[model samples]
Target: MKTRAAVMLAPGEDWKVAEIDLAPPRFGEVLVEFTHAGLCFSDEHLRHGGLGDLPAVGGHEGAGIIREIGEGVTGLAVGDHVAASFIPTCGRCDWCVSGHSNLCASAANSPGSADPDTFRFSLDGNTIPANCGLGTFARHSVVSAKTVIKVDPEIPLDVVAVVSCGVLTGWGAAVHAAEVRVGDTVVVVGAGGVGINAAQGARFAGAAHIVMVDVNPAKLEFAKRFGSTAEFDSPAKAAEYLWSVNPVAGGADVVIVCTGNTTQAVVTSAYEMLGTRGRLVLAGMSQDVFEPNVHLPGTQIVFREQTIRGTIYGSCNPRHEVPIILDLYRQGRINLDELVSATYRLDDINDGFADLRAGKNLRGVVAHG
Candidate 1:
């Protein structure tokens, strides 16, 4: 069958919405009719050759309904609403069995198709890899069941879509990775889609002060709605402010870097904001792989006992954490509705991303028919 999708043909090129051929689901896979796709900065990484190869379908964060289940698929059926997990889990893998499905071995092949030897999408008879193996940019996709979690139909699919990646990643970075405790002072750098949730997560974890650091004035103001106790234009200013208020500790207990483009400068600034024994969690993606992004002093880290850690998928197990995140949204503990600053049709995806680049949106959603 043919479906419309946004395809990235080469680096530094705009996404082209074109009709592509999609194959049916194979064993352990299902056909999904996407309802909403979240415009995440990680996808923007693909546009600049930061991750994944060219001639790929874009979109890793999305929620949809299962149109058909392939042979051997269980616990899901047609009409079931589900959210995509960028990291597909093979339950038998060591990481998955040990409660760390985010590091599942299957993710090693995420840049290509679910099966290393096959391609599920094609255009003009040429193979087109789906970004992260589950291309939600397309109207319909055939994805391995392991990469989707059945979601409650009552919850909005748009909310479900963002929760699958940004919300879960940010929330887990604080609650799980950083192990935020009550009364702790936390600083989150970058108030974009991911950073805002880190602030929300800190609040949820009972942090007394959740400081959001970002240059975008609009995002700084918007951060307050999700639980930011204060906002600053830069990490240096945030660090200065944190030292004044958190006199005893001298700085924040935790610092989470959620900038869209992680750089060595950002890492150094985030590290400088840490208090004694503070934890700095790197949840952002660094585009430059050739140079080291981290340049912390080993002596200070050893003496202060500060920890610098990196997380993928926010150190969350998609099947377990995704449901809990949705529940948090359902109980009003987390605000999923306000996270979406704007929405657009699939055809207007480029405009949505342009708004993201211009810092005009907290999070953009593509509302599919």
Candidate 2:
């Protein structure tokens, strides 16, 4: 069938909304009709040659309904509501079996065609890969069952869409990876879609002080509503304030970096802002060219007992964590509505990303008709 989609034909190219063809799902795959899709920075990373893969569909975080189920698929059926996980997990893998499903073994391999020699989405016969193997940028998608999670139909799809990536990653960065505890001083860098939720997670985890760092005054102002006790326009200023408040420690208990463009300098700053045995969580996306600058000396890391950790999917299992997060939203524990700063139509994808680059929106969604 023919479907409309935002395709990144090449790196540094603007998203082009084109009519594409989708093949019927094969065994173990399900066809999804997306209701809403989130404009995540990871997709922006793809656009700017960060991932090195182009000619692909552009969105990963989305909520949709199973329009059709393929052969040999189980636990999901047509008419069921679902969310797309950027990282597909094989439940039988060692990581998944050990409750560390976030690092599924299958993730080590590329998200290739579900069936050999078959392409799901194509434009004028040229095969186009879907971003993260689950392209919610299109009106309809055929994704592997492993990457699709069942959700309650009662919840709104737009709210459910953002949780698939930013919400889960940020919230998990604090509660799961950072292990934020009662009365802890947590410093969250980058108060965008994900960083804001990191603050909320810290608050829920009982952190007494949630200091948010970002260059955007509006985003810092926005962070306060999500439990940020203080806000700063720069890392140096944030560190200064932390020292003033807790001079003895000279830093915070935990620091989470969720900026769109993470850097080694940012990591070093986060390291300097940690007390003894403090943990620094790097939860942002970055390009490969900056790989040489990601180092920290042995003395500071070993003697101080300070730990630095890199996380994907916020270290939370999607199939399990997605529902738990939705429950939080259902009970009014986390705020989803406010996270959606704006919405756009499929053709306006470029403008949506411009807003993301300009820091005008916490999250931008593409609402389909």
Candidate 3:
């Protein structure tokens, strides 16, 4: 099959929207006809030379229906409504067995699984990679069936697609990854797609106060609708406010950083804004050389006992969490529609990333054929 997709040819390059051929689904694979795709900042990283290796199709957050199922595939059939998980959870990996399916072993080879070590998409058989392997930028894509999850039919395609990454990442960071609780004060850095969800998840989890930090005015505004009790334009203010909230306002119980900025200074600041025994979760990615400089001072940690952890895809299980998160959306407990601040056609895809970087949209969706 041939597909029209936005191809990111290399690092520091713009995406090329063109027609390419798609291959048939192989073993344990499914082909989806996507109606909606979410433009994510992580994909933006690919455009700006992140982690190198490119000439790929990009679109991990997509909503569509199964059009075909490959050999050895069962439990998923054609015409089933599904949200395509960009990261495939093999269900057999050690992490999957432990309920942390996002770190599936299959995820490491997601880019290579399409077979021929090439791509279903090619101009003259030239290889093209898919961002997370479920390239929904194209009208249709053949993806690993293990990465696809059936979703509620009542949910809108745009709503489901955005949550496939942004919403789920943010929400899961607070719920599953951070395990937020009642009366706990949480601070979310970035205030964009992932950060806003963390704010909302903290609120839904009964947080006493939700503080959102972002440099962008627009993004800070978007975070407000998602249960952010307070907003800060800088981390300095976030730290100051953390101490100023109340006399008992020791510090933040949890801090989830989604900015993906690889600055040691930023990481250090995020780590410092915590109370005794506070948990700090790093949801952001640092540059290749950007290992954080963290001081686990015996006096600070032994007495306060701060725990620092890293989160991968919000520690989510798509098959288990997608529907659960969707139910919350349906019940109006979680704000899905608010997360979608803008939409684009597949042709205007690059503009979607522009909005994300400008912090103009909490999340952007691509309307596909």
Top candidate (TM-score): 1
The TM-score of predicted model 2 comes to: 0.96
- Candidate order by TM-score, decreasing, is 1, 2, 3
Candidate 3, superposed: residue stretches over 4 Å from native: 109-118, 246-249, 287-299
In the predicted model 3, the residue pairs found to clash are 9-55, 12-49, 56-129
Query: lDDT scores for all predictions?
Result: 0.90, 0.88, 0.80
Error of 1 at 86 (Å): 0.5
Alpha-carbon error at 336 in model 2, in Å? 1.1
All candidates: TM-score: 0.97, 0.96, 0.93
lDDT of 1 by residue, 118-204 (tens): 468998898777889889999999888999999999999999999999998999899989999999999999999999899888999
Q: How far is candidate 2 from the true structure (C-alpha RMSD, Å)?
A: 1.8
Q: What is the TM-score of candidate 1?
A: 0.97
For model 3, give the 10-residue run with minimal summed lDDT: 109-118
